[model samples]
Target: MNKAQRLLHILMTMQAHRKFNLKELTEEFGVSKRTILRDLQELSELGVPLYSELGVHGGYQLLRDRMLPPIHFSDKEAVALFLVAESLKGYPMLPFEAEVESALKKFYHYSPPSTKEKIEKLRSHVLFHVQERGLDTPYLTSLLEASLEGRIVTITYEAEKGTSERDIQPIGVYTASGLWYCPAYCFRSREPRLFRADRITALKIVEDQSRRIDPPGYDLRDWFTGRPSGETAELVIHLTRAGAVRAKSDPLLAEGLTVHADGRGCVRRAAAISDLSCLADTLLGYGAKAEVEAPALLREMLLQRVNEIRELYAGAGG
Candidate 1:
């Protein structure tokens, strides 16, 4: 085999065997011990994590984080993978931003010229548009790691009411719209709550074993699929044709909207009472286009907000 081919084969073998002596590699490949030694040095120069042990009992060992063997992908598969990675660029922050960029660079560098041209063209035409967010979420990686490890964390959170420190066991972290959120069991509230990742000013993993508790049965997937889990009240809103079009722009409300024969539509669904205030704010933006048919509580909140707005501008127009 050519040196390049032999080098790749040896790398794969090292990954599999993990611990082998130079004599074994030389005998397996029918090469001199010096040749095997040269190949090993080249592998190390290529950034393979290879280490040698002293004495007769020891040989060579690949580190735990050794690179995977090469796998060929079809042109279409390569393009699809590029597109998927490109889509992640819409998000402002990612946990492994450097690794993603490195992978994308490698993909582009290794692709054939035709594939490179296609990717460059698609980069301009295909876009996954997400609203840009100004908030910084420096704790996103920490939150994600804690969730994966099922560890409790102490965070200083800046909520609308005020800033406070709390201990929480996170289910997971997810991005919605353009912001990151962590759904966790808050020890302070003794309930599941969703905290904005950007609002977490400080975080530290709690290593005290006594503080750990059994993980909740539900996780982020469950939270996303079947949300509004607690006690809920039915909400019904009548909308004009224009309101229907506008409501479709909102991810939260559009799921429950039903369009009628004429172009008018209605949002009819059960929503957690805790979410009524948020619903009120969203509907208030619709102004004359939307009318709350049921749920007097939402109407009251909307009226309260309107009155506050009126008070703020009451004498200004005079």
Candidate 2:
């Protein structure tokens, strides 16, 4: 069973028993004491009315009197909720993550057993993961709140060149590839710029704005459809079987991928990228499994990076 199922089982067990301790629950679940403790903690985070007492004579007891009514979900709604949660699988350090997590757990708990099985089986068959980049944005919730309220925000940000501070009018936030971005109207620059959410080192909510200058309409759909903001190149790449498999879910990498009948495929989507460095990083992640097949400059750059990485790791364990 998945963690959701295990959590639901724990919840049911606690509801049935008056004083089940960690050792007893651990033995029942065949999991470590630490795992049982984590489940209890998560349950508490989800607002479960659980109280624990000390000493061997004491154990955990659920507050049945304060229990909330069971939530009902239709079969389709349950599946949609599960899929939406799954889509955020690798989003790093999301805003109000605990609440979001608690909601998902409850969604699972309330789902019908048949619906849960379908979710689990589909989940097990597919894999999606993204390595978190170097930075994390913990103030994301604040920024999102400020954006909706039409308030100005002061932020200290770090980029490739250096660090700087700015007060900006938050337009919106979106995720691309595997990173979070805030496209806002910079008060200093007087133009819309995309800020990496994780690169925001500091954030402060300013006073509500009376005279809000509407930010130029920005749409993420355009970018997803291969329209980038700045200079771009039309390049091509041949995908070994592995690269094709990985690209299926990638926002940019999946664009324009053509798979021939012979189980061979290629992606002609270099124009879909706005940031060259991001494209390079995506290609590097695929290693030799992705071959740059066009645009001599990009091909050369990828080759050089591959050679450098190979040399750096070549002598390991020698």
Candidate 3:
């Protein structure tokens, strides 16, 4: 294997074993003992906890360090990492910001010369979807870290009712409409909910010890896989000329909703309606351009919202 590939293999071996001796690695890689020693030294320099073992059974082995940097990635991996990090620019305040930054810094620092050069090229050529109205990146980053670590978060969330501080158990990070959203189960509601990463003004990682308390039989993946539930309905949305572009490109809608061009914009159909209120609001945001075609109930849902707006604004100055 080439130097980069060899390094990756050695790292993988170290991760799998408590230690590796020069003789074993040399035999494994068909290299000299000196070369294996050099490779181990290189890994050590990169902040890997690889250490040489002495005695009869002693060999080079990775020390158990939870804080050790991960093995180097291939060229594609290097570029992908940068892309992921850059994308986080949309949500800056996530709890994992420091960890992500540290990991990236180390990865770049130890990346092979060719891989580093490729990363530079990739950085110049790539573009991320930028939000017209930006969000606080740091907060989003923190929320992400907390969520990944299974920590409950406290945030002053603005709901339709108004603003309220909620202790939420973040489940995963979701991206929608060029913005990141966190899926969580609200402690108050005891149900699954989504919080806009951008709209969250302040976030605090709660330490009350409430944990991965998913509902009786809640499976995030299965729920998102369009499972039917008592509280949720299946709603189909048909988009007009302008709405097609968004429907086709939106990650959330694109996965669950079937889309096709209808000369005007596009038509989308889906059978999951866990958040009809939010979905209706999204459709309304498209104005008269989008329509809910199937499930008469969803049509009524949108119409009710429209009537409410009409009633609220009637006789008011525009």
Candidate 4:
């Protein structure tokens, strides 16, 4: 965090906790004691109440009952808050929906009128199209809160086998591909595992006084950015001219595809196949325009999926 953000955070922490020594502040911010001392001085100059006690364990303390005054959010921060809140606008059954409304109101209230007006205009200039999958995320807020508080939760989750209970210490919540997921340390798995938030049928926060805390500096971004350790079988497919054109419309499919003069195309490199049913559905959508050149396993799976689709349609028609 920048100096402005750090100063603002220190002021708020002082207000909330009443006392924080230089050592505690330095450790929290990962800055030097001198830096924290300088920060405290800056906070004082900014009209924050920061009376310091001078003793062996002397720490700066806000006066009792002194609240943090209204803060002016930086321009970038205001815009960022607006964007982040906007992303959650059209979700299905979000947890703490009322809190979200309150937060958005506060964000707008704190934003400069000029910034608010510009944001209104920017709505036309900036657009984020999200396809909400209509999954119930009732426990999202609780899970997120527990993650921050280092609390454990017991969850009854539906999986391929059946519903099973797990005691998990959540690291954080994240979103990908229109799904919310929580990565947590699971007692059942004896390791960190990602749980699909929608599959959680029941949730109970473990309010026991003692609970396992998430490891310090546990970051969801690292989990997302790290290379996945799942199996990825490669697909070597040949596409007709029409299929190639269609694939071009989907950047993922068109990636590393090479079209030839004969109006047939092959992947410049083999494509990594993850979901058999999804790939089958896509390829089948192209009719005879797509042909699997290699991978007998995939071909069989695709054929099986095709037969299933055909049977379903035939029965429906009958």
Candidate 5:
């Protein structure tokens, strides 16, 4: 790990154990005792009350009486922190907005001079977009914490056109298309399912006894590593020449597409597709050049949506 990551790890370790010996720190980080001692000293200088204890049971710890200034971040850490701050801004439901802002200020101030200069360049070069809104960052964060601790959580979720409260044992958090979702075993539904963080309105951690069964055996790491099973759809799209040209330029649209000979442009068989709304919007952007071929239901949905759009715009005079 880099220096910033190591420092963060050290802080987390100290938070968990409240104290650790030199040997333990050196062994855990695979660094020499000398190096670990230097890092600890640096931490102390940064206003981390890292006090060293004498004798066998005593070791390094945050001094009880003093408050520590924020830890310094390497360039990479600063960039990552800034990106996360930007992401959190998109989620209005997060309760810790002030905390995130505070941490970001400290990170920016403590970043190396070289990294500080790169921040603007990085921001201009990198970008991310999220379509859904009102995501409950606080709730999502709580669920992740609960999953790590194997605890239960109660959440108020807004379903399509309605709302209800539920208690669930969250297995893990998953991200797809710039949105975070949680997979859990809902106590009310008594089944394993997924929930979009954007739809969650409130959350509370329940006692551990609320767990219904030993948490599901599904491998959470495997589930969130990529597209989880059951989240994707298979479709066949027929694109005209213009549509194919435009789609070929889009990495997102072209993924998992197999082209077949059609009269005008080509037929594409697609799999593992999510966000049908985005798909329709993209196709509509190509005007009449793109049309769904198979999955008649999806085709009709797109066609109806297009027709509605035409009607809505028909009154505009030349």
Candidate 6:
């Protein structure tokens, strides 16, 4: 076999046998010991995490997080992966931002010239538009790690009420509307609460195991698809054609929307009381296109906001 083919085979072989000696590779590929040694050096240079041992029981070992063997992808699969990575560019921050960019660069560098041209053309035509957000979520990676490890963390959060510190065990971190959020079990409140990632001014893992709380197995999918748990009231809103079109664009509101053949629709779902103010703000933007039909509390909140706006404008005019 050619040197190039032999080198690839050796990498695959080493991956299969995590620990091997130069003699074994020499015998397996029918190459000289010196040549096998040179191949191992080349692999090391290519960032394969390999190390040698001096003791009798030791030979060569791949590190626990060794680089994976090369993977072949079809043209379509390559393009799809590129598109997925490209979509992340819309977000202001990501837990693995550097890794994504590195992988994308490698994909572009290794692809055939014709495939590169096709990818460049597709980049211009395909776009995943997300609203740009100014806030930076520097703690996204830390929050994600805490969730995976089931560790508690103390965060200095800047909420609407004011800045405060609290300990929480995070369920997970997710992004929507170009902003990052963490759903966690707040020790201070003794309940699950969502916090804006960017608002976390400071964070550090709570190393004291005694302070850790057993977090619920809360599925983020439920947060997206189903109504929140605990006390909630039914919300119903009549929508005009334009309102229906606008509501369909919202990930949360669209879940409960139903459209009829006449181009009209309604939003009917159970909404937590704690969420009414935020819901009022969102629906208020719909203006005359949407009319609240149920839930007196939400209507009241909307009215209060309207009055506040009118009062401010009146004072300005005066």
Q: Model 1 segments beyond 4 Å from truth?
A: 1-7, 20-48, 52-60, 65-67, 209-217, 227-231, 307-318
TM-score result, candidate 5: 0.51
Model 3 segments more than 4 A misplaced: 1-64, 67-95, 137-142, 149-153, 201-220, 226-230, 259-274, 293-318
lDDT per residue, candidate 4, 35-143, as tens digits?
A: 9888888667545666888999887788876554556677777887777766777566566788678657755754667899877876767767666697887888888
lDDT of prediction 5: 0.68
The residue-by-residue lDDT of candidate 2 on 149-260, one tens digit each, is 6678999998766999988877667776567878676777765566788889999876756546653554444435525544558878898887788888776577788877
Q: Write the per-residue lDDT of candidate 1 for residues 203-311, one digit (tens) a residue.
A: 9988784766674576688766775755678899999999999888775578789999999999998887767876787788899999998799999999999999998
lDDT of each: 0.84, 0.75, 0.69, 0.74, 0.68, 0.84
When summed lDDT is taken over every stretch of 10 residues in candidate 1, the lowest stretch is 209-218
Ranked by lDDT, the better of candidates 1 and 6 is 1
The RMSD of every model to the true structure, in order and in angstroms, is: 3.8, 11.5, 7.0, 10.6, 9.2, 3.5
The TM-score leader among the candidates is 6
TM-score against truth, every candidate = 0.80, 0.54, 0.62, 0.54, 0.51, 0.81
What shift in Å separates residue 90 of candidate 6 from its native position after superposition? Answer: 1.0
Q: Which stretches of candidate 6 lie over 4 Å from their true place?
A: 1-7, 19-47, 52-60, 209-218, 315-318
**What is the lDDT for 10 in model 2?**
85
Clashing residue pairs in candidate 5 (N, C-alpha, C atoms within 3 angstroms): none
Error of 2 at 109 (Å): 10
Worst 10 residues of 6 by lDDT: 214-223
Please say which candidate is ahead in TM-score: 4 or 5.
Answer: 4
What order do candidates take by TM-score, descending?
6, 1, 3, 2, 4, 5
Measured with C-alpha atoms, the lDDT of residue 181 in candidate 6 is 86
